[model samples]
Target: MAELVRRAGLPVSAEEAFAWHERPGAVERLLPPSAGIQVAQCSGTIRDGDRVKLQVSFGGVKVPWVLEYYGYEPGRRFCERQIEGVFARWSHERRFEPDGPDACFLEDRIDFQMPGLWPIRSWAERRILRGLEKTLRYRHDTVAADLAEHARWRDRPRLRIAVTGSSGLIGSALVPFLTTGGHSVQRLVRGRSGEHEGHVVWDPETGQLQADRLQPLDAVIHLAGENLAAGRWTAERKERIRASRVEATRRLCQSLARLLRPPRVLVVASAIGYYGDRGDELLDETSRPGRGFLADLCRDWEAASRPARSAGIRVVVARFGLVLSPRGGSLAKMLTPFRFGLGGRLGGGGQFWSWISLDDVLGALLHAIMTDELEGPVNFVAPEPVTNAQFTRTLARVLRRPAVLPVPAWALRIALGEMAREMVLPSARVVPRKLEQTGYPFRHRKLEWPLRHLLGRQTPE
Candidate 1:
C-alpha cells in the first residue's frame, strides 16, 4: 500500500468550523467540481461517522467504493477510514485550531492508496499521487478563498442581501461570489421561512418575501427572470417569459419600498437584447429599445425597478451581454460540435455576437456595487465584439477543427422559429464604454483568448 496527505488552512472559529464540518451537504459542495463521483451518498449523524458511498469515474470506467467515519468530535477534530473500496486503504482527518483571538484555522489531511494491489507498478502510483496532490492543493486554495470572503463579511457592516433565482446558472455562480466577497447573501427560496446562510424564502409567482427579510440591507442585485434563449418563443411562451421578469421585478421592488431600511443601491439585470437586431449598429448604454419581445421585456424589466428608485434607493440597470462559463453556457455547448469537426459558421456568419466572460460579468457587477459613481444603464459586454464568422473561426481553431460550413439563415429560421431570426441573427455591436470609463478592467477582453482559456487548450509553461 502507498500513502499521501493533503491539508487546508481556514480562517474560522473551531465552533463555526465544526458547524460547517457537521452540516449536511457541506462536504459535497467542497468536493472538487472536476471529480466525477456518482451516487455520492453521505449518511450518519456524525461528520466523521458518516459513510460516503460513491463510484469514481476515470477513463470511461467507474470504481465503486465505501468509506466510514472513524474519529468523531464536536469542534476540534474528526477522521474517516476506508471500509471497503477500490483503494488499498484510505484515511483522513480534519483539525480545527484557533489562529488568533478572532481567526481560526482548519487543516485537512488525507492519506490514500489508489487502483489497489495490481501490477500497476510504483512509478504509476507516484504519478497518480502527484496528480491527487495537485487536485488537493486546488481544493485548499478554494477553501482559502472562501474563508477570506467570509472574513470580509464578518469585518464589514452586516448588510442583508436577498437574492432571487438563486439556483439558476448566473445565480449559482453569483451567490458564491457574493458570499465569499463578505456580503451576507440570502436566496429567495420558494416556500419556507427564517433565513439560513442569509437565505430568505420568497415565491415570485405568489409575490411573497417575509416583509422583515428586507428590513436591513445595503444593496439589491435583481437577477431573477426567465431565460430568453432556452426554448422557441411561442406567443404564449413569450408572455410567460415577459411576465416572469416584469412581475417578479415589480413585486420585489415594491417589497423593498416597504422596508424601513431599504438597500441603498438596486443593481437589476437587463439584457443587451434591448437593442434588438440593429444590423451593424453599435449600441451603448443609451441605445433606444428595439421592437421585439426581448426588447419590450427588457424595457419593462428595468422599469419595474422604478418603485425602488422612487423610494430613494440608488438604482443601476445592468444591461448584460452573453455570459460565458467554462462548465456551462453557449461556449461550452458549442465546443461539442466543434470538437467533433462539425462546427461551422451560423447563418452566413455575418451577425455580430457581443458577449462577456462570466467572470467579467460578475466582476462588473461587483465593481458597480463598490463604485458609487456607477448608476443608470451599464453595458456588461466585453470591450471587443466579434462577428459570427469570427466566432466560428476562433472556436474551431481552438478545437483544431475546420469551419467549412455556413448554416443558411432559412435553415436556422425553420429550426428555431422566430428565435433564430431574432436572437441568433441580430447584430448589436455593444461596447462596455461606461464600465471602461469608470476604470473597470476586463479580465477577458477578446473572444479567442477567453474561448481558449475556457476550453483548457492554453496549457501553462
Candidate 2:
C-alpha cells in the first residue's frame, strides 16, 4: 500500500471548515475540472453508509469508481473507502484540527494500491502519487480560499433566497453553495410538475407567481434564460434568446416590484456580449453597450430589471465573461479537440477574451449579494484577460498538446455565421472594477492555475 498526506490551513473553526466539505456540492466543487472525472451519483452527504459514484473518461475509455463512507465524525474526522473501483485497495481519511480560535488545519491521508503485476504496480504507484499530489493540492487551495471568502460574512445572519434557473449549470452550483453557507434556498420552478421541498412554482412567460411564496426573501438571483449558444443565430433562434431574457426578466422584475416586502437585492444574469465586437477596448461596468444583436439583446435584457430597481431594490446585473469549466460551457467543447492535438486558434486568435473560472463567477455573485454597494452592472471576470491565441496556447501547453492551426475568420463566418463574428471572435477586455472596489477577491485570477487545477496537470515546484 502507498500512503499520501496533505494539509492546509483554513481561517475558520474546525467545525465550520469540516461542515463546508459535508455540503451538497463540496465534492463537485473540489473535483478538478480537467481531470476527466465527474460525480455520476452521490448520496448528497458525508455520513456512514453514504456512497458516491464517479465516472472518469480518458482516451475514450470510461471507468466507474464507487466510494463508501465509513468513519463519520461531525467536525474532526471522516473516512471513505473504495467499494468498487480501479485500484486493488483505496481508502482516504480527512481530519480537521483546531489551529486557533478562528482557524483550523485540514489534513488528508490516503492509502491505496494497484491491482497489477509487481513491476508495473511500482511504476503505476508513482504516477498515482503524483496525480494525488496535484489533486489534493488543488483541493486544499480551493477549500482554503473558499473558507477565507466565507470568513468575511462570518457574522452575517443566514438569509432566505429565491432563485430562478435552479436546474441550470450556475443555478445548480449556486443553490448548493448558498445552502452550504447557511442560507435557505427556495427554487423558483416554471411549473408545478417538478415541485419538491423548497420549490415554488411560477410562470415567467405569463408573469404569474405566488407572491406569498416569495415573502421574506433576502434576495433573488435570476438566472433563467434560453442558452445563447444552443444553435446557429437563425431568426427564430434569436427571437427565442431575446424573449427568454428580455421578456422573462421584465415579467419577473415587474412581479417582484409589486411585492409588499420585496427582496432587498435582485441579481440578474447578463453577458459580456453587451459590449459587442469592440476590438481591444477595455470595458468596465461604465463602458457603453456596443452594436449587434447580442448587444441589443443585453440592453433590453438589463432594461427589463428597471422595475425592481425603481421600486428601491438594489439590482445588480452580472455581466459574465467566458465561464470555464470542464463539465460544460465553451471550455468543455474545446477539450476534446485539444486533447486530440487538433486544437487551434479561432478567427486570427487576436480577439481579447475576458474569462472567469466557474468558482470565481459564483464568488462574484455571492459578493454581489452580500455587498450592498455593488449596484448596476458588475463584470464577473478574472483580473487578467487573455487573447484567444494566448488562451489556446495556454490550454494546449497544460494539455501538453500542439496548437498550431489557426482558424481563419472567413472560415468561421462561413461555418457559424453571425455567431462566429459576434460571440466567438469579438474582443471584450472586460475588468471587474465594481467587484474589486467592493473588495471581492477572486480565487482564480489567472488562466494557467485554474487550467492546471481542473485538468490535474502538474506544475514544477
Candidate 3:
C-alpha cells in the first residue's frame, strides 16, 4: 500500500472550515483544473454510503471512478473508499482539527494500491503522490483564501441581495457563493417569473421591476448586458450593446432609487474597455475616459448609476477585465483552438490585456458588497498585466503546444470589422489600485495559476 498525507492551515474554526466544504460548488472548486476530471454524479454528502462518480480524461482515453463515503463525522473527519475505479484499492480521509478560536488545520490522508497487473508499482506510486501533492495544495490554498475572504465580514448581519444576470456565468457562480455564505439571493429574471422563492421579473427596456419586491434587498448587483463578442459589431449590434448597458443601467438605477427602502449598495459591472486603446498607459479608477465607442458607452453606462447615488445609495462600478473561465468568456472561445495547437497571438501581440479569474471577479463583487468604504469605479483585475504575446505564450506553454503563428492586425480588422480594431487590438494596462488599497486578496493573482487550473494543466511538483 502507498500512503500520502498533506496538511494546510486555515483561518477559520474547525466547524467553519468543514462547513465551507459542504456548500454547493465546493467539490467543483476543490477539483484541480489540470486533472482533466469532472464530477459525473454525486449523492448525499460526507455521510456514510454517499457516492461520488467522476469522469477523468487523459490523452484520448476517458475513465470513470466512483467512491463511497464512510466513517462520517461532522467538523472532524470523513473517509471515502474506492468502490469502482482505476486503483485496485483506495481509501482517503479528511480531518479538521481546531487550532484556535478562528483557525484550524486540515489534513488529508490517502492510501492506495495499483492494479495487480501493473508491474512497476513504485513508479506509479511516485507519480500519483506528486499529482496528489499538487492537487491538495490547490485545494488547501483555495479553502484558506475563501475562508479568509469571508472572515472580514464575520460580524456583519446576513443580507438579501438582488442580482441581475443571475443566470449568466458570473451570476450563476455568485448566487451560490452568496447563499453558501449565509446570505439570501434574489434573481431578477427578464421574462415570466418562476414559482421559486427568490425570483423577481423585470423589463430593462421599460425600466420596470416590481418595486414592492425590492424592499427587502440590502444590495443589487447588475451584470446583465449583451455579449459584445457574440458576433460582428454592426451598427445595430453596436446600438444594442449601448442600449443594453447604458439604458438598462439607467432604468435599473432609476427603479431602485424610487424604492421605499433603497438598497444600501448598488454594484454594477463595467469593463476596462472604458480606457479605450491607450497603448501602454497605466490606468486606474481615476484615469480619464479614453475615446471610442466602447469607452464612451462605458462612461455613459457608469453615469446612468447617478440616480441611485443621488438617492443615498453607495454605488460601485466594477470595471471588469477579461474574465477567465473555461465555462465562458474569451478563454472559453479560445480553448478549442488552443487545445488543437491552432492558437497564436493577435495583431503583433503587444497590446496589454488586464485579466482576472472568474473566482476573483466573484470575490471582488462580494468585497464591494461587504466593504462600505469602496464606492465609485473599482478596477477588477489581477495585479499582473500581461501583453498579448506573453498571454499566448503562457497559454501555449500550459497546453504544451507551440504558438509560432501570429494573426495580423489587418486580418482581424477584415474578419471582425470595428470590434477587431477596438476590442481585440486595444491595449489597456489597468491596475486594481482601489482593490489593493482595500486589501482584497486575489485567490489567483497570477496568470499561469488560473490558466493551469482552468485548463487542468498539471503543475510540476
Which candidate leads in TM-score?
2
List candidate 2 stretches off by more than 4 Å.
53-64, 114-127, 193-195, 210-215
Report the lDDT tens digits of candidate 1 across residue range 1-461.
56666555666666665665565444543554445655456672355457878788878798877878767877788888888776666887777787766556677676766663456646667876775665566555555654544453364564556677767767776765665444567677776655354567677776777766544777778887787778898989988887889988888888888877788888899989889988888888887889877788889988988998899888889998878765565675676688888889888788888999765776687778767789998999999989999989988887789988777889989989888877888888998989999988676888876665445454334
lDDT winner, 1 or 2: 2
Clashes of 2: 3
Residue pairs whose backbone atoms clash in candidate 3: 33-456, 34-456, 34-457
Query: Cα lDDT of all candidates, in order?
Result: 0.74, 0.88, 0.87
Higher-TM-score candidate among 1 and 2? Answer: 2
| TM-score of candidate 2 versus the correct structure, residues matched by position | 0.92
> Candidate 3, after superposition: displacement of residue 349 in Å?
1.7
Model 3 local distance difference test score: 0.87
Q: How far out, in Å, is residue 208 in model 3? A: 3.6
Candidate 3 local lDDT, 55-134, one digit each (tens): 88878688999999888889898899998888989999999999988899999999999875556887888898888877
Q: After superposition, how far is residue 247 of candidate 1 from its true place, in Å?
A: 1.8
Ranking by lDDT: 2, 3, 1
Error of 3 at 282 (Å): 1.7
Most accurate candidate by lDDT = 2
lDDT of 2 by residue, 226-306 (tens): 988877999999988899899999999999888888899999999999999888888999999999999999999999999
